[model samples]
Target chain A: MNETIQHLLNHRSIRKFKPHQLDQETIEILVRSAQAASTSSYQQAYAIVGVEEENLKQQLVEVASGQTYVADNSYFFVFCIDYHKHVLAAELASGSVDQTVETTEALIVGAVDAGLAAQNLVVAAESLGYGTVYIGSLRNDAAKVSELLELPSHVVPLFGVAVGIPDQQPGKKPRLPMDAVFHRNTYTDDDTMRQLLSQYEKETSSYYGERTDGRRTEGWVNQMAASMKDPKRTYLRHFLQEKHLSRD
Target chain B: MNETIQHLLNHRSIRKFKPHQLDQETIEILVRSAQAASTSSYQQAYAIVGVEEENLKQQLVEVASGQTYVADNSYFFVFCIDYHKHVLAAELASGSVDQTVETTEALIVGAVDAGLAAQNLVVAAESLGYGTVYIGSLRNDAAKVSELLELPSHVVPLFGVAVGIPDQQPGKKPRLPMDAVFHRNTYTDDDTMRQLLSQYEKETSSYYGERTDGRRTEGWVNQMAASMKDPKRTYLRHFLQEKHLSRD
Candidate 1:
């Protein structure tokens, strides 16, 4: 493998970080790298809010269900599906985008755009000897996050990334089997998918077992089944509508 | 900037590609790199379908509104938000994830997972000297594209990435100004946003004017207003509900 691919494969979410702050120059470079990702139809429908204030970070930690790393990082960035700029541009031209910006299609575009850019930022940070973790729990209270970030209508905070120098090393989580996730000309049939999942369950069960010294041995399927028993962030729909996004 | 950051900042979508097919080993490496990306809650809820058959590629090109590069590339991959494996696992465990898998939150999770993985694949491909472009036009005919791939329920194709050796050089598209897209501590207020956008409009107008030899001189705001005047892919909401995703 090449150096870049090797760097990617070595990725593990770091929850504990040293108290070393990232310089402004490094943050700008990371943001620039994020901007370089491809956008749907050149609609760069996303924004990054850098949360530096200690009080703001504490509020975010609470919103993230007490994930202390949300505050104890060199820097934190909240990625948002922001089309407020489009609204501004439309207003500048004396036009209206309400017919489009409120559609579900636009929401998907913003989400994908933000995701692509955030991944680039994470990869770039890793290359610069930093560690990062994506905080999807930010969506647990999306409205609170938006309020904290003072996001206007048409701008919904999707997730956050905390970047800092690593204070702890974590084992890489085992992913689904390649055959299961990568198909050929068409999707693999159900029988083949079941077989692959069965194989992965055994692999993951062993992984957790060894990692926890037999304290945890649940297989992948069981974990998924348990996790999916209840819906998460069910308020996201209302939040999106309140933000004037995906209302249709 | 570091080598990785420089590589990212130099990105430009290449629509034309040489007639060279990627070997299976190289494709495997790309897929592996994608799998290494972060997934929400370890729910690797996405899949990649590599389309190599000429007939299938032709159909996809049709779905993509005759983007011929969809078929002329070394490899084409459809990134899909897939929860089929979860369904299977739930079935095996005598549990149900219908409540969770059908929620809008799950759709966001899958979309973000797929986007993160796809960006990693693109970045890795570029590092290996391959040019790539994202074909979001696949959403123009989402149902047809799903049928073409024989994708099962609870799986939605988000977009496609076309990868190949570069056959043409293209200039990087100027993105929104950093101040416009990147806010400090909180979302920037409207006056500042407007000022930043005005600055960006001038930069982009000049960019398009110079690139087209003065044939096209529209600014960013004008383009956004025009694009957003009408909704694109209005069928996506119905499509997602039909696929048993985001039904809530």
Candidate 2:
């Protein structure tokens, strides 16, 4: 395999980080790499907010439900679904986009745009010998995050990425089987999917058991079921609507 | 800049592609790279469907509004936000996830998962000297695309990526100014955003004029305003809800 593919295969989330900070030039390179990602319809419907202030990072830590890494990382970035710029563009062109900006399609586009950019940033940071972890816990209290960041209408925080020098080497979590996630021509039938998942559960159970010295032997299916049994972030829809997104 | 960063900066979407099809090994490497992307809560809420059959590719081309490249590319992959495996997992654990899977938060997670994975696949393909273009037009008739792919419940097609040997070297589309997209500590004020956008409009207008030899000189703001004045894909929400996603 090539070095790039090898690097991708070696990815693992690093939670603990050293005290080192990224230089301005490295930060610029990461952000520019993110900007190079593909945007839908050339509507770059996302923004990156860099948080370096101690107080602001602490507030974000609380919003992330006490994830200290939010504040401990060398750098933290909040990826947001930002249509406020589009609103400004509309005003300048003497046009109204109220109807369009509030659609569910718009929300999906923003989320996808933000996600694409964030992944690019993560990849770039990893290539530069930095460790990164996606702080999806920001969604635990997205409204608090939005308020803390002073986000405007049509702008919402989706997630964050914390990058720094690695202080811990985390094991790579095994993913689902190739046959399970990669379908050929069409989606696999339910029976075939179930068989593939059953096979995967055994593999995952072994992985967890070995990793935790037999303390955590639960398989992928059980873990997924437990998490799926309870709804999470139920207020997200209402919050998006309140922010004038996905109102339709 | 590192080689990876330079590669990312040189990205440009290719609409035309050579007739060469990718070998199975290359496809496996690309998909495996995608699977390595981070997933929120390790949900892995997405799947990739490879389209190699000429007939199916033709059907997808029709779904994407007659974009011939959808069929002409060396390979096409439909990235889907898939929770069908989660449903199966719930069944295996004797638990129910219907309530959780229908929530807006679930939809957003799935979209992000799909987008992250798609971006990784794109980056891997480009590193391997392949040209790629994202086909958001698949959403133009998502239902038809879904039906053609035989997708199941809790699975929705977000977008497609057409990858192949380079047949054309397209100019890079200029993105927004760094100040416009990258905020510090908090969202930028409206006045600063307006100024940055005005500056960007001039650059974009000049870009379009030079590219088309003065035939297409519209600025970014005008283009955005015109596209945003009327909503597109009003049927997406209804379609997603019908697929048992984001119903809540």
After superposition, the stretches of candidate 1 with alpha carbons farther than 4 Å from their true spots are: none
lDDT tens digits, residues B1-248, model 1?
A: 67777779999999999999999999999999999999999999998999989999999999999999999999999999999899999998899998899898998999999999999999999989999999999999999999999999999999999999999999887899999999999899999999988888899999999999999998899899998899999999999999889888
**Model 2 spans with C-alpha error above 4 angstroms:** none
Candidate 2 TM-score to native: 0.99
What is the per-residue lDDT of model 1 for residues A39-79, given as tens digits with 9 covering 90 to 100?
99888999999999999999999999999999999999999
Q: What clash pairs does model 1 have?
A: none
Clashing pairs in 2: none
Residue-level lDDT tens digits of model 2 in B51-106: 98899999888888899999998899999999999999899889989899999999
Instruction: Indicate the worst ten consecutive residues by lDDT in candidate 2 chain B.
Output: B1-10
DockQ of 1: 0.90
Clashes of each: 0, 0
Q: What share of the true interface contacts does candidate 1 keep?
A: 0.86
